[model samples]
Target chain A: MFWMTWRQHRLTLASLAVVFLGLAGGYLLSGAAMRGSLSLEAVQKCFVGTPLTCPEWAGVISTDRNLRQTLLPVLPALVGVFLGAPLVSRELEQRTFRYAWTQAITPRHWLTSKVLLLGSAVTLLGAVFAAVYRWWFTPATTGAVTLYDWFDVFDQGVLSFPSACLFAFALGVLAGTLTRRVVLGMGSALVGFLAVFLPLAIWVRPNYLPTLRVDADSYYSQSGGWATDFVYLDRDGNEFGMWEALSRAGVTSTTSFGSEQEELLARAGFREMVDYHPGDRFWVFQLIEAGIFVALAAGCVALTFWLVRRRSV
Target chain B: MTETAIAATRLGKRYGQKWALRDCTLRVPAGRVVGLVGPNGAGKSTLMNLLVGLDRPTTGELDLLGERVGPNRALDRVAYIDQEHTLYRNFRVHEVLKAGRLLNPRWHEQDAVDRLHELNIPLTSKVGRLSGGQRAQVAVAAALARRPDLLILDEPVASLDPVARRDLMATLMAAKADRDCTIVLSSHVVSELERLCDHLVVLDHGEVRLAGDIDDLLDGHRLLTGPAATADRAPVGTCRVVHQERAGDQVSLLVRGAPPAADPAWHARRVNLEELVMHYLASAADTTGGGKHPAVLG
Candidate 1:
């Protein structure tokens, strides 16, 4: 069964390997150059309150960072489209399942073997890609690059990326089983991955860890955290939006009261608060999101097995 | 020891509101080449699929070689050749044999290899590139290599030319001679079935219209030609009238289960397998309102 799986999918796997190697090579080359620029003495001094050559070094890091960030999300999509969607859909579309399922091995065994072998390969590939990207984009010890803040890259370079790949692969399998058409399955899997991923990344991930409430005066200086909300608290400790508080204070225009109203509000115990998640919770958030995706992947696999067993040829 | 190759009691498969096969009960003894004849949508494929465990029956029970049909022990001893001769088009001829060997514990690799070689089929050719006849042969080789106790082939030669059909039948006969395995082959061509099968099963409208040994069915059914006046009355004997047709003053009757006693007014002749099968199918169609033939019964 292993040999059969390999023989059938060798071309797709080889093509994926080539693309991965190309991406790795590209990252390694640019990464070495970025490290060389960050290691300079002038760059090191400029990172610590000096303005000389800092902008130049920051430019180099941002150039590499921007490209990596844009391409990183596509890796899981590629795995889903290439490996996962066609895993079963191709056989069904071509009527090859009739031959495959009728072998001495049962359909359940055939599906289990394929999913295990191919799913593991997809997970491992995602891990390798993540590891390479992580090593390439490691922050400098003391340089302008050291002050660089990019939470998206950190989240993507850890366990979250590989977990997302697994989820996408399983989603592809489910879509393939349901649709029984390779192109439709691939399209639906890609769409399904995005549908699941975007909601968690945009809405759910920030609250995975407890948010911190700090004075709004210090919010601008707190550069290494994600700010979720800004609200004003009344003397009774009830939170209200800026417009509602202003309306209650009978100030329809914000330009009219200016700083005087601010002092009066502060004296009356109306403090503006900022809700945020600090940067230090990056690993914690990674694990939480990874757990969510892994759970989803398991669900997709379970559903696929149940459907395969129940479906008629 | 059990001598039945296949036994099904009220086996049925339903697709939504329609039944592809229903209430199909049959018992085929071992070591006989049985021909399954049916028209389009007659449930021949459905029955074969059920026998090989490709699809589970929606109702009732089916047993193959004394074991229940399922993914367990039954599959290891029963091989199936689907109507299309489904093989991996990407794999080379030898790779298919290798797959058979890997998938089956009792695979006879040398026999498959030898059979392909003798048929002048190249080992390196992709299955998709082979001619229809060659593809059928490779499929047969793969099935035979498994050394199954019962081989169920659905429309194996439905698409082959006469020459290819002959070659395939020869190959099947050789395999049966070597292994003494029970073979159930389905086809719409009655002449081919007559030449290749000792036992016959006719299906129509998802029901078994006729079934028995070829010789027994032939011996039981007699074609009687007489005046149209006598056609309205049933033949005198233990025989049952299966079908009748009248043209001008002549009437012809197909009788089943017994041959009528000799009468000077009627000329009784033995019905060929094709005529017998056609009559049963026509009668079934008429009974089901699928055709214009009038239903006749004794």
Candidate 2:
């Protein structure tokens, strides 16, 4: 199985080199460009009132805000899709499973060897990317905000990024094992990721976040017909709009207003109120979701192993 | 009792409406090389597949190296060289051999590597780039390297050129000479089987037309030539009449059984392995009425 896997993946070592060089080169050049513009002399003179330049570390961390924000989520997911699609499907496609299964070792041992060997390579690649992201972004405090104090809809934790990537990888493996076609596996994985992510990001959590609601008649009387149109929610650093008063009214049932949200609304004495404002337990939510996603990823990996081991072809 | 290296009793397999192999009972003792010969679609591969545990027999049992090998066989003890190139083409020759070593518990890695070296197969050369004969050699090397107690080959040298075929047969012969591993090889090429096989199992459709020690099969089987009109009557002590053909006054009847020397008018002739196979196939086809869809020998 290692021999077979190596045949498929060994050629990608060159591609790995190219991606690594491209990422580092892009990061370094952006940092250099930022350093040129944000010089200590210029910053001190231009923004003399603000203490933005007190620590040199912050400048280095914020070198390439756009690049970090754009590349972080996309790169790992791409790696997962690229590497996972062929991991098992290639064997079945080639019809070489016959050779492996006829050996003294059971199918379990055969699959275990492949997963242990190839999975280590994937883990190493992900780790290197994570380390680079950590190093390059430690100074540039500007980018997609983490779950530190800000509560953006995408404020998953530090591990969530890799966990998401690993989840995508496992998804790819599962797709390949089940479908036994590289193109189909890749397509299914991409489709599944979008299917899960779009709903979770756009619909589920946002509506669930603590919100404030008011009757259109009363609020519109006070603020003019503005209450009938929409309500733009600003919770932590994230912003979203509920379309019209009717949609905003549904937000109460969606978020499942907890005791804390109920108490806050009671203090304010509002008719309808669900607010996802900043709170201490936001990090706890991040940890819990990360755990769930990571556990899901683990389950996907386990299922792939089972399917590959048992499949006749 | 002398241990039988391989045994199949009432082995049967059917695919949909077609019976690929049925009621196949044969035994080859330890250290004997068995040749399973038949026409294309004659259940040779099906029987081999059943023995190797690649496909289960629909009705019967197979015992290999003392273990019943249907659902609970120790598959590792048996080495199967499939009819196609089983090696991953993208892997190097050395790596393919390494995979054999990793998968088989009793692999004779050095012997396999040495044979590959002798054949001048490149260790670092990828299998995809190798010639057809060379690719075949790599598969053979992997099978032989495992030093399995029973080596089952299905059309082992089907695609090789004449010279490569000779060399491969020589290598297989040498392996059998070194260790008394039972080798059961299936081939349509009877000439090749004549060189190495000690036991014979002749199949037509899904049934065994004839089977026994090579000497016994050859001795008991004969082709008799007489007038076309004389062919209608069965020969005395005839077990089976393979085929009958006529040209004017001359009629050739391929028969299985010893003919009396006293019969002067009827000529009794011995048949080689190839001639015997042709006769069986021709007769098997004739019984099916010589149509495009030949009836399987039930």
Candidate 3:
């Protein structure tokens, strides 16, 4: 079974690995170059008055945001389209499954063994991407950003990201089993990968741990946390709208704010409160997300087993 | 060794509203070359699929080599080639044989290699590049090398030209000469099995029409020819007319059970295997609202 799987998909697997490794190498090199000239230590030493001028540690962070917006929806599902979708769909579509299943082994065993070997290949590559991606943005994430920025890093961490890859592969198998069409299965895998992770990212993840509320004098004190929402309360301790506070401070227009905006809001009889998840809970959220995806992956694998056993084709 | 190789008790398969096969009960004895004969959609492939465990029965029981049709039960002892003659077109011919060796618990690499060499099939050529006849030979070589106790081929020669069909059957007969395997081959063409099979099973519209030893089936029935005017009258003794056709003023009827041939009313001759199979299939078509429709309209 192992030989057959490899023999059939060696070219596809090799191409995917090359593409993933190339992307990883690019990210690592660009990340290292971000801090090559002006190291963080130089910025620290400038404060000692030796160099007198602080050379800013300029790390490109906008690309990371773009990746989160664009690449993430399609990245992990590449394995689904190239590897997992065609795993069973090819056999079924081409009618080679009739030949494969009638051997000494059972169809369930044939499908299960092939999926395990190939699933491990994708998961290993996904780990490489996760570790490299997290390292790629390490300088920017730790230098001047809030701990809330670490949430994005955790999304690309070993636990969560690799689980998404495995989940997508398993979903591709299930789609192939259901539809028995190679193209349709690949499409479903891509769509399902986003349908699951997009909702988790938007609504389910932040709720994994309860939000910590903080009373801080200035926004700087809450910089390291994921500041999801801000509440403006009058001295009477009742929450008021931000627009009301701005208008009461005689802010005629909403378009621009001066450097003294904090003082203006403070003078409007408002105290600031923040609801956030601390940066220290990074691994905890990673584990939660990974557990959910892995659980779903296991369900798809088990269902594929049952389907292959009873499948007439 | 004389035990039944395949036994199905009231086996049936229904897809949605239509039944592809229904109430099909059969027992094929071990070591006999059996022909499962039927017309298109006569449940021949359906029965073969059930024997090979490719399909589950909607009702009733099926046993292959005294074992239930489940994963890995009788699988090692059974080999099946579907109607399409499935193979991985991407792999080389030798790689296909290697796959057979790797997949089966019992491997006969020498036998497969020797057979292919004898057939002059190029081992290095990709299966996709091989001719249809060569591909079919490779499939047969792999199957025969498995040394299964029961070999089921579903419409094995349906796609082959006459020469390929003859070559494939020759190889099969040569393999059957030595092995103790029971072969159940399904074909819509009766002439193909007339020269190959010892036992016969005929089906029509998902039901069993006739089944027994080929010689026994032939001997148990006789063809009676007489005037068309007397065709409506029953024959002498317990003989029953299975099928009949008219030409000019004469009508010939296939009668089951031996009638007294010495009677002066009609001429009696022994029925051939093709005649027996065609009569059963034709009579089945008659009862199923299909036969003689054009004739009646004309």
Q: Per-residue lDDT for A48-114 in model 3, tens only?
A: 3322344342223445567766885457788887787888888999989889888888877787788
Q: What clash pairs does model 3 have?
A: none
lDDT (tens digit, per residue) of candidate 1 on B1-298: 3599999999998999989998999999998899999888999988887887777889989888898875433387788898889899989998998888887887988888899999999999999999999999999999999988898899988888889989999999989889888999998888887877999999887888888889989988888888888776646477778878776778888887655566777888888889899888877876787755653433
Q: Whose DockQ is greatest here?
A: 3
lDDT minimum window of 10 residues, candidate 1 chain A: A140-149
Worst 10 residues of 2 chain A by lDDT: A223-232
Please say which candidate is ahead in DockQ: 1 or 3.
3
After TM-score superposition, the amount by which residue B176's alpha carbon in candidate 1 deviates from its true location, in angstroms, is 1.4
**CAPRI-style quality class for the chain A–B interface of candidate 3:** medium
RMSD of 2: 8.1
Q: What Cα-based lDDT does every candidate model obtain? A: 0.81, 0.67, 0.80
Q: Where does model 1 sit among the CAPRI classes?
A: medium
Q: Which stretches of candidate 3 lie over 4 Å from their true place?
A: A30-65, A141-148, A216-219, A234-253, A256-264, B71-74, B292-298
Order of the predicted models by TM-score, top scorer first: 3, 1, 2
Q: Candidate 3 residues B16-105, lDDT tens each?
A: 898999998888889989999988889998888778777778888988888878554438888988876789999998899889988998
Evaluated at residue B239, the lDDT of candidate 1 is 72
Q: Best candidate, TM-score-wise?
A: 3
Report the alpha-carbon TM-score of model 2 versus the true structure: 0.73
Per-residue lDDT over A126-235 for candidate 2, one digit per residue giving the tens place of the 0 to 100 score: 55555555444433223232212223323323555556666767777787788888788877777876666556545654443344455434443332111112333333
